[model samples]
Each structure stands twice: as structure tokens, then as C-alpha cells.
Target chain A: MTGPPDDETRDRIDDELPDGEPPEDAPDGATGDPVPVADGGFADESAEPHEPRIAFYGGKWASTVPIVFFIFWAIVQSGVLGIGDTNGLVIGALVGTILGMFLVRGDWKAYADTIFEGMTQRVAATAIVAWLWAGMFAETLQVGGFVGGLIFAADALNVGATTFPAAAFVLCGLLATGIGTGYGATVAFVTLFFPAGVLLGANPVLLFAAILSGAVFGDNLAPVSDTTIVSAVTQDADIGGVVASRFKYAILAAVPAFAAYLIMGSVLSGASLEGAAALRESATAPGLVHLISMGVVIATAVAGRHIVEAVSWGLIVAVAFNLAFGLSSVADILVFTTTSPTPAAALPFVRVGETAGVGGSLYSGAIGFFPLIVLTLLIVAMAQIMIRGGGFEAILEFLLDSVATTVRRAELTMVLGTAAINGMITINTAAEIAIAPYIARLGEKFNINGYRRANILDANTSALGYIFPWAGGVLVGYQVMVGPDGLGEQYGPEMVVNPIEVVPYVFHGWFLVIVFLLAAITGFGREYIPDRISEEVSRA
Target chain B: MSRFEKFLAGWSLRSSTPDYEPGDVIEVMVTGAEGDRAIARIGDSTLRIEGAPGDAADTRIRVAVETWDETAHRGTGTYRETVGESAF
Candidate 1:
């Protein structure tokens, strides 16, 4: 297959086409020019009259109203209310879209059409596809006893209670980096390691923070990670280049983070020594097979294989290992059972006597990301509306003209801008997508390297997403902490870890942001790619 | 380059062609072509020009560098609309 389109081809295509803007003379609410195909070639004749096209409606300030409202509502709903519900976010997006209608000068139909156009855009679809595959892979690994394997390794090491948190941090970071999903790491570590650490008398808050810190490391460095993918693709940097460039920064921050955990782990172990022997005995050998499964993903990704193919291979191997070693049954890996009151019985695939609940690792793993996938698509749709309305351009002009007069200032803007967006938005991937365009546009103006831009964009996006109490990563981790099968039942309700308490302890996440900020100001670990434009086109 | 230089190559942002600046018009030999873009050679460095019409490859072309990223040793150039007869 041919490589990605070259820079001149991309610029030509972008210059000729106005993504959704109406013509100056077009009637109110009327669809503007037909979409222009790349090559400065054919028009998309299939576009219907009522189809919404992106058009500038008013001044920059007016265009920004929708995005401003969305951010405000998000902060109030998720941050203030401390509710991380996907449904609530979806509602906020809908409300913001409706509110944006008044700011447009066109007919109501044109505005409505724009929303539809934004929702089904290719960028949003691409992210959703990756999330589905990642979700499945993560879930499968979990079902195949991946976490159990880590537990076994920890037990075999015979670590003291004081050192357990630090050890757990490193292991969780490695697992997250390999798997490329912080949420998956949070679920696994909180469910398995948190309880184990508690039993060994480790401080609950510190232990939980260490797990989050590991997640931030993985989210920032892992090639398969959603934030990493978004940052690389949006900035037009090769995934391999982005990953390689980020290694120094990730390691620089991790060294201090690991040391902190080690010191805290020793200073904070408060558990009585009586129950440690029983906990160690419960660890098993079969779980260790998953270490091979994680290795498969990392190896394939680093070899420059497509991410989807790499993860698929990892998922298949995990399932095979789980079954062949008798670690879990095939039915346990995937099963469908039916009962009298259940509607599943009517389906042809349902056996009369077979159990029909969605069980096993494979089925739940892929299905687990459905809500997040939908949420990402809707948020992108809202972002598209903001982009077409000139809100993004207005913000870009302000930053470029005022704050980013010098290269150092520009890099700092990229860092702080990405961080600010991710902080207000509970979902990191969505925030990355929203802010990626600004980074690309602004970075290119200063001739910043694609690798540098991707690194800065992703570092802050990953860090802010975990450090804040309202963040999806922290909330997800907290939810699993208090769930029925979580520490609440195992160690009583008093042992439940609150999301707020863990925020201050997420040292890795906080350190990453600081590292990037310092890198921006001091030019540490900063490199610009001379002469070469990014290979991938900016999707935003 | 010394061994220490090689080791730090990937970690540092030193430019291979430090003298090139944005908007400088120059003539370069097209060394390679990919799709609609042309790769032009200048001394030891390479420049990528997008949207150059076909057949511009394997020929000398006068272009203006729109942007130059020194550390990456690459720049985006636009084909000059007019050149003096002796430009080549």
C-alpha cells in the first residue's frame, strides 16, 4: 500500500475545501458547496440539499459559545457533582448543541444538519473503532487471569508490606504500558492488588495512588494507548516516532516517582503480620502465563505492525493460554446461558437447556467499551460543530498573536492548553481529540517537530486525566474500589477508598505534567525535526 | 560524528542544515518522487515539496521554503511561480 499523502497534497486539499462553511451568498440554512475530493478533483455529488455543511456564522466570540457551555457544564456535572456517569456527559453534549443553535445566523435546519455531519465524521469513527478493539483486548486479558499472574509474581517475591506499594506501582505501570489502557489497569489493580495490599497493612490511599501513577505512565508511553494514538494521529506524527521521542521524558519522571513510592511504601506499612502467610498461599502459578500475552502486544507494536493487528494477536494468545493451561474453561472464557424469564431464550443460537448470561472474558471485554465509544463519538461531534463555527480559529489566533510570540512561549502554550482542556473534561481521549488541532496548527507555525508536539499533547492529556478527583480514570478506579466484590465486602465498608483521597497521592500523574511544563520552559528533552513535515495528515 | 554524538543523536535537537531559513528561494535537484510530492536534495539534506505537478521529478526546480524545522532536517516548500531565465 502507498504511504500517507504528502504535505503539499494535504495543504492543497485543505486550502480548496471549506469543511462545513456556507458560501457568502448562500441563502439562510442552505447547504453550501459540495465536498471537494482530494487531488483538487471531483465533487461529492451524493451530498443532499439538506445535508449540513460547516460554515462561519458569526464572529469568533459567538462561535465559541457552544464549546464554552460544554466545558462549563462538564466541570459542574463531573467535577463539582463528582458524578462520572457517561449518560450525564452525553446529556451535557446534547444540551450544548441545542444552546449553540441560537449563535448561528442560518435556519434551524442548517444548524441541525451540522450536528449530524459532526457526529459521523471520520475522525470520531476512527477513534471509536480503536477503542472497541482495545476494550476487547483489555477485557480478554483480565478474564484470562492476567491480574492473578501479577499477584502470583508479587507473592513469589515475598516483598515486605512497606515495599509492596512501590513494587505494585512498577508492575502495574508495566502492565498498563503493554496493554495500553489505564482504565483496564485501574480495574485489575484495584480489584486484585488493592485488597492484597490492604491485607498486608499498606496505606489504602497511597497504594491506590501508586496504581494511578502506573496508569499515567502507561497511558503516556504505551503505543496501543488511546491518548497516544489520538496524539500521534492528530499531530500527523508516526506512532513509532512519537513513542520513541517520549521515552526520555517518561523515564525522567518515572525515576523520581518510583523512588517516592519506595519511600512511602516503607514508611506507610501499618498492617499486622498475622494474615500475610495465608495471602501468600492463595497466589497461583497458572496466572503467570499472561505475562507472555502482554509481551506479544509490546513486541508487535514496537516492530511497527498495525496496532489493531498487534492487539488482536495478543487477545488470541491470551485466550489460548487461558484454556490450554486449564486456568479458565472455554465456557468461562465465553458462555451464553438462557433462563425462563430471560428474553435470550427466543434467539436461535440459544440452546434450550444452555445457560444464557453474557459470561467469559471475550464477550464482556469487547462489550465493556460500548458506553465510552458512544460518548467519544458524541463529544467529537460537538467538537466538530465548534471547529466549523470558527471557535477553534478564534482561540488559535488569540494564542498565536498574543501568548506565543516566541518558540518557547509557543511550546508552553501547547503544554498548558492541552492540560487545561483535559482538566475540565473528564474523558482524556475526548479532550485530546478536541485540543489536538490547536497543537498541530500552532506547532507548525513555529516549525515544531511532529514528535515534540505529539509528546507534549499526550503527556498533559494523560497526566491531567488521572490526577483530578473527577477524572474518569480516578473515578473508575474508585468505583471498583467500592463495588460489592471490591474492598468493601472483602475488608469491610470502612476500607473503601474515596476518589478524593487518592488525588493528592497520584504522584506520577502530577510529576508528568510538571516535567512537561519544565520541558516547555527549559527545553529539556525538546527536539525539533528540521525540514520534514509530519507524514500523517491532521484529521482535525 | 563521535560515538558520544551518535548516542545522543536521537535525544538532541541539533540541526543537520542550520543555515536554511523560511522564505529563502533556492534551486534544488529533485532526487526522488512519491505520489504528488517531490523530494529535493540540497547538499547533504533533503526537502519535501507537496503538490508539485508530475514530471517535476528528476529535474531542477526553483521553490520557496515555507517552513524549516532544523532539528528534523526537513522543510515544506512551495513551487515558485516565476524564476529568472538564468535561475537554474
Candidate 2:
């Protein structure tokens, strides 16, 4: 398949060849290959390359345009714009789009086409499939009582209250990785883990912090995650390469973050689960069948399966387990698929309804990723138009000439550029999708290993999103903290840890930033080699 | 070595091409254990050694390799290398 033209090819086409000595294999002559049109002759028909006129749009000033709208919406939705909570992002985006129409001086036709192109590319398709499967698997498992089972198991372990935060963090991290969405992870933890932590008398702030940190860890590291998919695809790297490359950095920040939560929990709570013994005695250990469903999802993801296939298989396995074990009837599973009071109903697990047989819970996990799917396609279409219109040419040319001259600076630029984009968007997955094309093109220019580029992009996007107060991860975690008997009630607004409150507490995010910086200066973990592809024998 | 093996052995494993020259002072935004900070310096590749997980940092820190291996972790924080001058 034809991919982006490489540097050597593009340069040769620019006609900067010295004298009459065009290099061998150059596209300069003869009957073997199509020749370029001479300076004075022939219609310039190199496939009518749809090279749109060069012009700048107000929308091209992404940082300025997107950021203002995001901030305005954030303030509004966050109650800074008004006293009531209402979705503000849609209004913000609408304003941005309208502003683009007025401020951008480019061809209106090109802009209109760009909308279609941006929203229906391969990048968007991949994201849609990945999210859908992830949603289905996570929802199915939730229905099966996977999360409740996790709590029961944790309770059974008789952990000290001080350490419960750490344990809970680990579990949530696993859940996010398995499910593939930091936002979903946040939601799961708030509904399932948060209430449980409060009942056990754990330090509410620490508990909330633990959940946020865990979600970030999984979002940064998971192979199926939107950020991971975007970072890899944009960099022209494979998913495995990205996941593997970033593993070191994620773990580097994660381990300490986990320990810090544990330490904080210990210091703040100064005790074990208040009713651990009694809860363990009374809490029926949900059937191990539920655990099997969760295991199927995590194991398949780690096994290097494509996320959709892995999650699909996981759903089937979960359903089978539910019915086979008599844990849930078919009808019960179906009812659980839409909306369940219990978070596990969101997972693949089936539970007995008030009266029904087995069925899958929100079993259409793939459908849940529809928003991201649409967002990705739209972003890609927009990116293509930008590319077609030379929106990227000026910036790319400058970056290629300047940063490309220095290896360390280039690496640093990539990390920071990705981080800045995500910081503005406040959504890791969507940010990854929008900025992927540039990131990939930049890496190829410098011969940066796809894996390294992908890793840096994903790590930075993950880190920056959580550190920003307007981020979904932060917002959802904040919501969980304000509920009755939550962090807000325990510590008041002073200790309640809003998005702003938790930004400073995001130690993992800070650690990641430091690691990348040191790597650039010292060139310690840099990988200069590309993975080799095997040659296949020509078919007869 | 076989042709493929030899080629693989000689290949540069570093992610980016070695484009920076010695003594070229450059500014970089460093992020990791210490958080986001910028540093500038004239690079001296000879003295900039790659760091191990438990290794003590004398002046420079190691960057992560492109390959994702569990051993690449240097504590619970990322380590980076840069010339020690502040950019901002």
C-alpha cells in the first residue's frame, strides 16, 4: 500500500540535483518508470496532485483557537462560567468552528471537504473498532459482577486500611488496562471502589487520588487504549512497539506512585479496613466464574491480540461462563447490557435479574466507543484537509530544518508537542487521534524509531491530561470526591482535591516529564535501531 | 555472521539518527522524576553515560531505550540526560 512519501523520494522530486549527475534510481529518465515533466514542456499531469492553494486559517492556529474555547467551556461546565453544571464542550466546539469559518481565509470548499476527509480515514476506523470492543468487554464484565467480586476478594485479603488505597489503585489499574479507557476506569472506580473505600474508613483524598492515578497508568500503558492506538498509528509504528517502548516509563512512574499512595493511605488512615473481618464473614465470595471473565480480557490483551478480537472472544467466554455455571440466566444478561446500578453490569458478567434468564450486559461495548469513533474520523478528515492545503507544510518545513538538525531537541519537541496538544484537549484518546499525523511525519523525517516516538507521545499525552484540571480523568475523580461521605465531606473544600487540587498530587505525571528530559540530555534509553521486517518470497 | 545477522548487529538501536554534534549547545525541556523543567548545555557525548535502574546519578541520567522491557525501569521514575544548564 502507498504510504506517506519518504524524505529521499520527496527531496529528489524537488529538483535540487547537482549538475547532470542525477543519482541512479532517481525518477529522472527512461521508459522503465514514469518521468517527471520537463521545465518547459508537457501538461503538469503527475496525477493532478490535488495540491490546494497555500493559505493560513484561523483554525490553523490550534493552540490559540482550541485552548481559548476549551478554557471557556471548562470554566462554564466547571461552574466557573455559571453556578450550575451543564455540558459546555459542545458549545465551546461550536464557537470554535464558527470562529474558524470567519477567521480562516482559505477556500470554503476545501474546508467543507476537509470535514469529510478528517472523519473517515483509516486512523478513525481503527480507533472506532478498538473502543467498541473495549466498551463491550468492560461492560460485559461489569454486568458479571467482576468489580464486586474484586472488592469481595480484597476484603477477604484483610488488608490494613492504610494499604487498602494501594491495593485499590492496583485493581483499578488492572481494570482500566483491561477496559482500555481512563474515563471508563474513573467511572468504574468512583461507583465501585470509591464507596467501598469510604465504608472501610480509608482516607478519602488518598482513596480518590489512588483511583485517578490508576486510571492514568492504564491509559498510558494499555495497548488497546485510544492514546496508545493514536500514538502508534500516527507515528507509523505498530501497537506492540508503542506499548513495549512506553512500558519502562509507565512502570517507572507507576511503582513510586503506587507506593506513595500506600504511604499516604497509611499515614492518613492509621488503621486497617474498619469492618474487614465482618465484611469478609458476611460477603459471599462471588463465583470464581466472574474472575474468569476478567482474566480472559486482560490475558488476551497482553497476549498481543488485536483489541477487538480479544474483547469479542472475551465477551463470548464471559457469557458461556455465566450460563455454564448457572450464575446468571440469558435474559438477565440482556437486561444488564443497557444500564446497571452495579458497575460490574457494565462488564461482561451476567447476574440473576429480579426475574430472568442469562443475557450479555451492556454487551454492545463497541457501541459505547461511538463518540470517540466519530471524533477520530472527524479529526482525521480535518488533518487530511490540512495536509492537502499545506497547513502542515510550513510548520513541518521549519521543524524539519531546525529540530531535525539536532537529535535531542527533536525528541524533546515531539514529547512536548504531544503533551501540549493533549493538555489543550483534556482528552488523551482524542488528542492522540488529532495530532497523530504530524507526530508520525516528524518521526520519519528524523529517522526516529517508531516505537520511541509512539512511546513518548503516549506517555506525554497520558501524563499531561491528568495533570490539567479540566481533564476528564481529573473531573470525574473530583465528582467522586464530592459525594456524601467522600473526600469533600471528610476534608471540606480545603482538602477535597478538585482537578486543581490533584494536579500537584500527580507525582507520576511529574516523574514522566523528568524521565523524558533526562533521556534527551543523556541519550540513555534511546533506541536508534528499527525493527527489521522479513522478506517474503515472490508468489509464482 | 550471516548477512541478516551482521546487518542487525551493526544497526543503530537508538531511536533517532545521531544528528547532534559535540560541543553544540542546545536547550531541552526535561520531564521525569523531577517534573517538567528545561535545561541547556553543550553536549559531550563521551561523558554522557547510560544509567541503570539502581545506578547512582553523578551528573547525567539515562533515557529509555526504544524496546519495552520490564528492566528498563529505573526506580518508579523516568531518568533523562541533558546538559545541565537551565533553559528557562
Candidate 3:
């Protein structure tokens, strides 16, 4: 009797039906049939789940692709099968592209379009602008004899040779901060200050290490830096906010490094102070006018002007100082800074000096940026193709679904990821771009603030780029140590510090990595997440 | 125009446009698409644009957009023009 519909149930069913035909109001699976989902899942009734897209070369290629080339390049360059200089980046790109062709599902034409879009668009524009201005400023300062001036300033202070490393680090930090580039600062220090330190009988390896440390400090902090820009923009934080948020961490690492350098200077070397006569003769008081140029740039930056505008103002000030102080002629400044210079005719700018003038300084600075800009564009294009073709998406999805879950782990992973990439690439700027997206997305998943993310990305990238053996900074330092006029060749190999030997001496780099790790573990800098204001206003 | 020229022009937004001399402070209906509408203040010399969405309309404005904290979120969408510069 209960098997049949009860009177209450029958009444409820009838009440639920519309006043029209019952057939029109029947359930989806009525009429002695059941509806089937398209993909056999409850949600798949209307659409399919989003599957992970694959690239032409899976991420396995990022590992093996570089190794194959490493083997080949090692054989060719070092005449050994297993041993070679780290030339893995070129190989990685080539092998990755080839592998991509096999696994990527997108049309070949889309891949081509993606490459062009990546190469010529965002990265290229940013690179060109940054390198051009940075080059100009650096060259101008050099031509203006800023480095020589710095030496003069140091010498007059009666500082002993033993204390030079500590002093150099502070000065180098300031230079990098002023110029807004760590790599540029490193190059400048190597060319000018490195030789001077060797002459002063300072430990050459220690000296080079100091220079690199200083560079890292600046790159970590400078508002105008590429890494800084990348960090802020990717994390959606204002520049000032990012800098402020990271200030405590940077200082935490920096103070210890400074102290270590001072102590090491005391223990490893003794002061052979230069006499006043020697100091006065060697030192050239950097004309007050030259410092004016730097002042203009700093003032403008602090005043919250746009970067381009600030740089332009700095350029103008530098040019004025060059002419006003009779530092260099206009023609010299122009010819030196000119791109695509032809040797057919002499430029009028060359007439003012036996060497080059302020113009040449500007020109050299601008030209130096060319290769970096090209590299940035090419790398960006390659990355874009990988992304648009589903390579990036695949990697990102895997990271999200399987790898990144907790905030602490995600932050640690980001720091380590940047360091790992930078070690291989040896180019901090390029490395930052390749890994920035993943870091940002990971932070967002955990509701991390833009400033914290930017801080971690830059600090780690800056540290790793100089510590690795294959890094450009290390190579240059090593070359200087071994060159004919270099410290090793002049005095002895004992006097010159090879980069391989100096790695152990690079205490700051090692310390920073450890500090960052500890910071991550303790979650000290992690509280700045979900920043309520823009980077500009956060600090203010 | 040449293809290259057109391409360059597209990227170089600050250049090519006629210089505007300041008269009365004017409000221009920021033109784009829906969900991204903004009103820009046109001063004598500068065209201040927003990096993000916000309430302030002086020169800079911040807009709220969904972006991952780790990656760059490029906001590309349509914004209808809400106002135009009124010529006195």
C-alpha cells in the first residue's frame, strides 16, 4: 500500500506543477529516459573542464635542453668533453625552441606572431628607454671624472689601504643608488676602482667582492633600476611603497655585511696609510659642478617626477655642467654619444679633446646599452611565444595546482626560483623578466602584497647574479686580475684574486642568501602583504 | 603612412597629438569602453593618465583591477567616453 504515491506526496507533486500541460513542465530526464552529461561529470553538463595546455617543448626541456648545449660548447671552447664555461643559456634557447615545435599544438603562424609580439613590444620598449638613459648618465659621469673624483675624496680622508674595501662598499652603494643600476655600478667599479684598489695593495679578490656587494645593495634599492621597476609593476605596487617595505630587510642584510667587511679589513690586512703629500698629489677634487649633476637627478627623483622626465632633467644638468666647467666641448659630447657612428668623416665634437669629450662619455653610455636592449627583446619574444603557445600556461597551472599552496612555501620558492634562474642566465635583468610572472601570480594566490613580492624578487635576483662563477661580474674581475697590466701579472698570482678564488670571499652574497632564507622562515617581512596604498604613498 | 610609421605612432602616444594650451580647467570624457570609463583633467601642457582606477581626478587616478600579486595584469578592455572637453 505504501508502494503507491501517498496522498500528501501526490498533492505536493501536483502543487509543484504549472497550470499548463504537465508535459511542458517535466524534469530533464522525464519520459522513461535519463539525460547524460557530455563529459560524464555533474559540471560537464554544459561545458568541459579546462585542461592543462602543453607547449612544443615541455618544461623538461628547461633542464635537459641547456645541458646538451653545455656539452657541445664545453667541447668547442675548453677542448674538453665534460668541462666548459657556463654557456648553457644559448643552448637552452635553441633546444627549447626545437622541442617546442614537436609538443606545441598551436598553429605555426600563431607561434610566429607571438614571438614578434613579445620581441618588439613591452620588453623592447622598456629596455631601450632604460639602457639609453643609464648609458648616457654613466658615461657622462665617467667622462666628468666622477670615479677619479671619488678616489680623490677617499684619499684626502687619510683612509688606509686596509680599510678600502669597507669604504668602497659604502661609496659603491651610493653610486648605484644615484645611478639606479647595480650592474652598471659593478662595471664602473671594476674599470676604475678595482685597479686602484690593487695598486693600494688591498686584497684584490676581497676588493672585487666588495664592489659586487655594493652593486647588489644598490640594485636592491634603487628606484630607477630595471629590477625595481619589474618588481613594482608585476606586483602592482607603487615604486616608493616597494622600496620602503623592503628597506628593513635590505638594512638587516647590509649592516652585517658592512661590519664583516670592516672586521675583515682589520684582520686580513693592515693599514699602510698614504701620506698627505701623496694623497694631495693623487687626488683631484671632483669639481663642485660635477656633483651638481648628480644633485639634480636625485632631487628630481625624490620629488616624485616620472622616470623619463627625471632622467631628462639629469641629462640637461650634466650637459650644462660639462660646458660651464669647461669639462668637455659640446661637439665632443655629441660625437661621443652618437649611435651608428661612421668613420668616413671626423665629427666636430672630437676637436675639443685629445681623447673624447663629455659627448663621447654620453655616446659610450648609450652604445653600451645596445646589446642589453637586444637581448631583452629577444628573450621577451621567446618567452611570449612560449606563453601564447600554451607553454607558460602549462607550467603556471602545474605550479598552482601541485607546487604552490602555502604562502610561506610560495615565497621561499619565488626567492629560490629567481636565484636559480639568475645563476644560469648570469644576466640579472633578463632573469627577472623570465620568472616575474610566476612570482606575482603565486603571491596573489596567497593574498601577498605587491611590495613584499617585489622586494623578494629583486633581493634574490640581485644576490644570485654576482655570486655565481659564470656571472659577468666574476669574469670581468678575473680578467682584470690576470691581464698583463693587472695585479697578478704585475705582482704575482697571489696578489690577483681570481673569481673562482673570490667566490669564498664574497661573504655579503652568501650572507644575504642566508638572511633572506631566514626572513622567509621567520615570516618577518611577510606582514606587509595586502598593502592598503600605492607604493608612493605607503612610505609617505 | 608607412607600416612602420603607423606602428611607431601607435606606441608613441605622447607625441603626434596637438599641443593644448591651458585656458579654463577642462574635463575631457576619457574614451575607451564600458567598465573602464574615466574622466581626465586636461591642463595646459600635460595629459595625466591613470595607472590604475581610483576616485581622484586631478592628474593621476588609481583603478582597481583584479591582478595576481606575482604577475602583471594587463588591463585591456573597452571604456565608453563619459565626458568631452567643452569648448567655451
Instruction: Give TM per candidate.
Output: 0.66, 0.59, 0.59
Cα lDDT of model 1 by residue, B1-88, tens digit = 3434322434544332334688887655454554567665442245778666665543445778888887776777887642211101
Of 1 and 2, the candidate ranking higher by TM-score: 1
Ranked by TM-score from best down, the candidates are: 1, 2, 3
CAPRI tier for the interface of model 2: incorrect
> Which digits, one per residue and each the tens of the lDDT, describe model 3 over residues B1-88?
3324322221111111123222212223221212233322111112333332433221122222222121221222122222211110
Which one wins by DockQ: 1 or 3?
1
Backbone clashes in model 3: 29
Model 3 Cα lDDT, one tens digit per residue, A1-540 = 001222453333334433522323122233343332111111111111111122233332332233234324433543323222233334544554455445433334444554566666653575467546755664566556554565675567766567888877887788777667665566556645665564565666677888888888887888777778777776666776676667767777888888878777767752233342454355466443556776676577656675567667877887777777776666546654334345623755533334533435566556544544443454555555544433333444444556444455666677777676566554566667766766654554344456667788888887886775555445434443443233344335454454554566666667777777776656665632212433242322
lDDT-wise, the better of 1 and 2 is 1
Q: Provide chain B TM-scores across all predictions.
A: 0.64, 0.20, 0.20
| Candidate 3 whole-model C-alpha lDDT, 0 to 1 | 0.52
Where is model 2 chain A poorest over a 10-residue stretch in terms of lDDT? Answer: A36-45
Regions of model 2 farther than 4 Å from truth: A1-59, A62-67, A79-86, A121-140, A172-195, A202-212, A215-246, A267-282, A319-332, A336-406, A425-451, A465-502, A527-540, B1-88
Q: What tens-digit string does per-residue lDDT give for candidate 2 at B8-87?
A: 33122353323343333322212211212211111211112123232221122333332222232111222354433111
Backbone N/Cα/C clashes per model: 27, 76, 29
Worst 10 residues of 1 chain A by lDDT: A40-49
Question: What RMSD does each model have against the real structure?
Answer: 10.0, 14.4, 18.5
